[model samples]
Target: MTDTPENGAAAPTAAPQITSRVLAQYIRDMSFENILAQKGVTGDAQPEIQVQVNLDARKRSTDNQYEVITKLNITSKTKEKGDPLFVLEIEYAGVFHVEGVPEDQMHPYLLIECPRITFPFLRRIVSDVTRDGGFPPLNLETIDFLALYRSELARRAESEKAKAN
Candidate 1:
């Protein structure tokens, strides 16, 4: 605790310190499909890619640690035929040791921070797998975890308010 010069009262304590360590991370599932090879679609055109992401976290009953999973699905297809070009799906998970976060903030910390720590590894895997699967390496864009968390919170609040109404 630090003392203030002007007032005789002591200053407030520091904010709660939060620390996170990744215990382990692994690929729970992975799939890379080159639809052009399977369907023999001849095309020299660049395919439009679409990516989707999902996050889930749960507390382990045994050790009180948290397990966070980040799921990503990427698909590319032509504009005219809408035929599939390539599909890549990955489910990456990590065990995180989180300390000093308050109960009210724990959920967001686990969902956002833990995944933020583990996403680079998942991104690398996606790139490597696509290149190995005979296609150009697919470099994914960086994600905004904080925006996602805030949006999720707002959506939930709106849903509850609707139910109450």
Candidate 2:
């Protein structure tokens, strides 16, 4: 038995279903510089690593398609003397076909959800690059996309406010 309206009628509205598919993913650009190897640094030296991440999203010529690019700049140096160790820069991009998301939410969906879907592959590449460059594998911690999105929005707001002043 189903609960019906007082007049014995059924509900007429349902929410739209959201669907997303990854059409393709690739490394758009990458560069790894082994500064330590180039400088010939020897004798057990400590390593300090820094990583920076940036994101961009743009619409494709095709309908319902968008491209999201994640850019990472990584550097490693010796903790003791602050000598250079290695630097890795990479841009990874994904093509997604998305449907049913509201227009207002498309930006966040593209920046956050799409990157979250493709992050594992990016992580693997970073780890492999570091290991192959003669250092231990560098495993990155999980990123909080929601927090990142909010921070970026706040930054843009401040920039616009300053420009107006």
Candidate 3:
């Protein structure tokens, strides 16, 4: 037993902890399309583009690691009820080695942090694919990961409340 100089309490001697996150990243899946099947399908009006995004995270059985995936789907059409111009879909995933993160913090870390690291690559891919598909490069805007995470939490809470009712 040892005593501290001021309070007469022994301080435990332990090595400092090290926390690691996002060890590696890679594109798990990607897809692009030009439904029009023609180089320039220029019509009288510019096509309307719709973008949809989704995110999911899960823990690995190996422990202290997680898999995070971000998927993006885009569609372009002349109007609400018109022939589709082009469709693009991408599913990107990353393997993250998270350590020393509390259970409460793990969810946000995976959904927000992991996606932040992976989005740039995904964005570049989208741009390249659209360019090669014979259209102007589609540069995706930066996603609001924090807002997405919060919305997901709210959705889950609403679902649980509905179940209770």
lDDT of each: 0.87, 0.93, 0.82
In lDDT terms, how accurate is model 2? 0.93
Per-residue alpha-carbon lDDT of model 3 for 5-114, expressed as tens digits? 57776776765463766666777777776877864455653568888999988888887888999988998887645677889988888888878666777788888888
* lDDT of model 2, residue 145: 82
RMSD for all candidates, in order, please: 2.1, 2.3, 4.0
Q: Please, what is the TM-score per model?
A: 0.90, 0.91, 0.79
Better of 1 and 2 by lDDT: 2
Minimal lDDT window, size 10, model 3? 38-47
Candidate topping lDDT:
2
Clashing pairs in 1: none
The candidates, ranked best first by lDDT, are: 2, 1, 3
lDDT string, candidate 1, 1-165, tens digits:
556856677777999988878889999998888888888676664678899988999998756489999999999888767888899998999998888999998998888888899988988998898888888888888999999889988999999999999
In model 2, which range of ten residues has the least summed lDDT? 36-45
